[model samples]
Target: MSSSTEPLPKLFTPLTAGDIALANRIIMAPLTRNRATHGSDAPNALNVEYYRQRATAGLIISEGTQISQQGQGYIWTPGIYSPAQIEGWKGVTEAVHAEGGKIVAQIWHVGRVSHVSLQPDNRAPVAPSAIVAPTKTYLESGFTAVSQPRELAAEELPGIVADYARAAENARKAGFDGVEIHGANGYLIDQFLKDGTNQREDAYGGSIENRVRFPLAVVDAVANAIGKGRVGIRISPVSPANGISDTDPQAVFGHFVEKLGRRGLAFLHVVEGATGGPRDIAPFDYAALRRAFKGVYIANNGFDRESAIEAVESGRADAVAFGKAFIANPDLVARLERNAPLNALQAETLYGGDARGYTDYPFLTEKAA
Candidate 1:
């Protein structure tokens, strides 16, 4: 569709981020559907089909996979801890690979954004401080206010880091191409990073350097488990998702990104503004953060076909991750290439549901037929 004078657009060109090679720059962002196997909390046939349908994405970052039962905040999400869970995820990885797609596990730990019922033995959730987040977690009954959390002891920090490393290893064993550390959306790592939730005076929570210590440690351990090239991390500087905020995100994230640059990780997936909300909900310089990271920089949060092309063509972002768009369009890459209309999203089925909104989204070719 182009002449010799114009080269292929960067958005559709091949890219190598660390060890993972991609056919295009369009990526599928992690979306939690709460549709994992009910009792096991493992990926099942539905999950496998759901991902397989969207394998056209250059890369698929799996939903927030809990590293351990204690790390869970919502019901019916998948985990990489148990043997059965590992086997269950193997089916998913195989399906994605068979479709010639690269996938990564988004390893996660929800700090205080959890209900007591979701915690291990109904114990209180743990966080950097004992403060409860002004958020609600999805449960079997319905959405409920998150429970008060106990302050995590400094000694327990190593164990949490170890859990992340184990999850990375488990992901590789389950045939994942890599792992993406979930450091965004007011999750465990985000709780430790922001000043609002992290009121601890201990070494893990006082200053910016101290706050970023645990996240970096987890990065080190996960990279050690799998190769550094097989690891990426997602961060939200100003996103107040799940009631997280910082007094000065620019200074905090600037230093954090600078430290990440030295690690030579695969990529940095950043939620530029408010997670799942307005991109300009707060004033923060995402470009500065992008410049700080040395590897591929993935820009997320509210991007369309035109903006995606512009971001990649101008080198503002190496790639663009689409969440809701991918949910509504399985043949998103082809649709974007042809500038085709995307199917409307079924809002009610965004969370826990059957194939109606999950795998039943018709392909572009099917519409033509």
Candidate 2:
């Protein structure tokens, strides 16, 4: 909306974080469309089309791609460590670049929030502690209850960090402009950061500094594998998504952010409220958290055009990532620029589909085409 023909909104301005550059501040949040299993459990032409259609976004963060077989939790989600998987992503990166867009792969490791069926040896998933959550995972059939996990030994901790670094290298080879470490959403890293699930007495748990140690190690690994300027990390400080809770989110995340800021990564993307839930519940000092970090801040969850503009203008956030909006309106930047109506996303076809709600969503210019 910084264009003269459009509304002069802060969301339309150009911004850069470390090595990544954006023509605008509207980002396409990572989304799981769940069509990989029909192909090779890797990216295919369908995945290419889905991201290409949304190239209008300033930055596209790919859906959580498992760092290894052990990192996988949901069926049909892509992985980044295999040669074939890296090859599969080539078309996606090429297509996005062809449209003059920038994208990054989000490397993930879903810890105990997984099922035995999704594990490497049909064994229990590993975590900082052997805790089970009320979370459910999507299978080919439908959502199933999550299985309990085996607690990871202190010796095996470095191996998990190596997987993240390997995935970062694979993302680079796949032609991704960058890679984002999935340290949020009750995954392996989040499980260690928060005190609720991380009851271990090792160096990786108990106190906030010790809790953030592993996540910070992964950050260092990925930053060393790729350039620090090309690495980003996402965190859900207060979000209860996937049954994750922090005893002291402020102290925990404050220490986490302060530590991460020193790493000089590209940016920090946060799920402001419960991931995709109400924002006003149990408020925390988000602005202080924003100021604590010296790098770019992406405010996500329940953001619309008005709120997005307000956040940027008020200097509360440098960008905003939209999930459902980007899903329904691929050219969300254009729609927001002209302040136009959007095509509502078909709730049924959000995942595991051909192209109905995927690439077939019409742009504003194509409404009558």
Candidate 3:
């Protein structure tokens, strides 16, 4: 179908990414729910129900799943490193697929945005440099400042890249349709991408080329592990989330996106504005960045229905991803189709909880009744 003839309210529009055809363009952005089973860090039945409820999205990107024990920064977050964890994720993927939906796993590593209490053996978090994250990570016990992270040796970079590669392989084993590298939100990849966090003088730091090396390596590794068509990456060029800031946001991210475009990945998901708190401001123009990256662009961050439609209609983005809106509206696609009002998300139950604010959110039909 031609882009012009595609119906505006057709939330189920088909989109083709290399080899895979999506049932719609409404991609579910990866969101951290922090509801994994304690100690086990495995996905539970509630997690399954949570994802299954939102299966109407053309594609569902699972929350940031840790690649290893050391990759976790928050309490009760799920991991893909263990057999039980893989089994747990299998249920989520199977449930989504059972409803004729496609899903991808967003593999993530928190880097220095971690507290000692959340680290393995209560050890320091790891990053390209010894700089501590300027933000705080939330825990059940409350929020705490991030501890100073140990600088990873150059030799250790390969292992970390392998961790992401292995996680992509594991996602395939878990029966996911694809994998999304969480290179955004000041995570491990973002820490390396931004200049403020990466103070190393080695090949991984100093110039923009050097700073983007680790993230590029990760992209190449994961793309190699899974075919390039099955791999995607998420980036926030001007994000200040987790105290991440780059010297020249436009030049650095423009080059980074240009380089990434050459790899022929499935799509590039760009989150505009501050991902976490209000501190990290957007310094670069998003439209300019969209022009630089010559691929399927999924624009995210604080977008409403009108703006989302305008983004697509204006050619600014191929699609728009919703976070909070989808959290409280399982039939989000239907609401958009009917131009109905969305349920406002309750601030209290965003993370670390059960079905109260999760699967219990009534659909538009139920609300009308």
Candidate 3 deviant stretches above 4 angstroms: 1-6, 9-12, 276-283
Scored by lDDT, the top model is: 1
Q: Provide the overall lDDT of each model, using Cα atoms, as 2-decimal numbers.
A: 0.94, 0.89, 0.85
After superposition, which runs of candidate 2 have C-alpha atoms over 4 Å from their true positions?
A: 1-7
* Clash pairs detected, candidate 2: none
Ranking by lDDT: 1, 2, 3
- Pick the winner on lDDT between candidates 1 and 2: 1
Residues 1-369 of candidate 1: C-alpha lDDT, one tens digit per residue: 445797867898888899999989999999999998988998999999999998889999999999998899999999999998999999999999999999999999998988888888999999999998998999888788999999999999999999999999999999999999999999999999999999989899989999999999999999999999999999999999999999999999999999999999999999988888899998988889888999999999999999999999988999999999999999999899878899999989987868889999999879999
Under the 3 Å rule for N, CA and C atoms, how many clashes does model 3 have? 0
TM-score of 1: 0.98
Across 1-369, the per-residue lDDT of candidate 3 in tens digits comes to 224575654334678765556887788899888899888998989999999999988788899999998898888889998999999999999999998888999999999888888887999999988988778887888677888899999999999999999999999999899899999988899888788888899999899999989999999999899899988889987777788887787888888898987888888998887774342365567777677666678888878778887777778888778888889999898888777888888989987878899889999889889
Each candidate's TM vs. the true structure?
Answer: 0.98, 0.97, 0.95
What is the RMSD of candidate 2?
1.4
Candidate 3, poorest ten consecutive residues by summed lDDT: 1-10
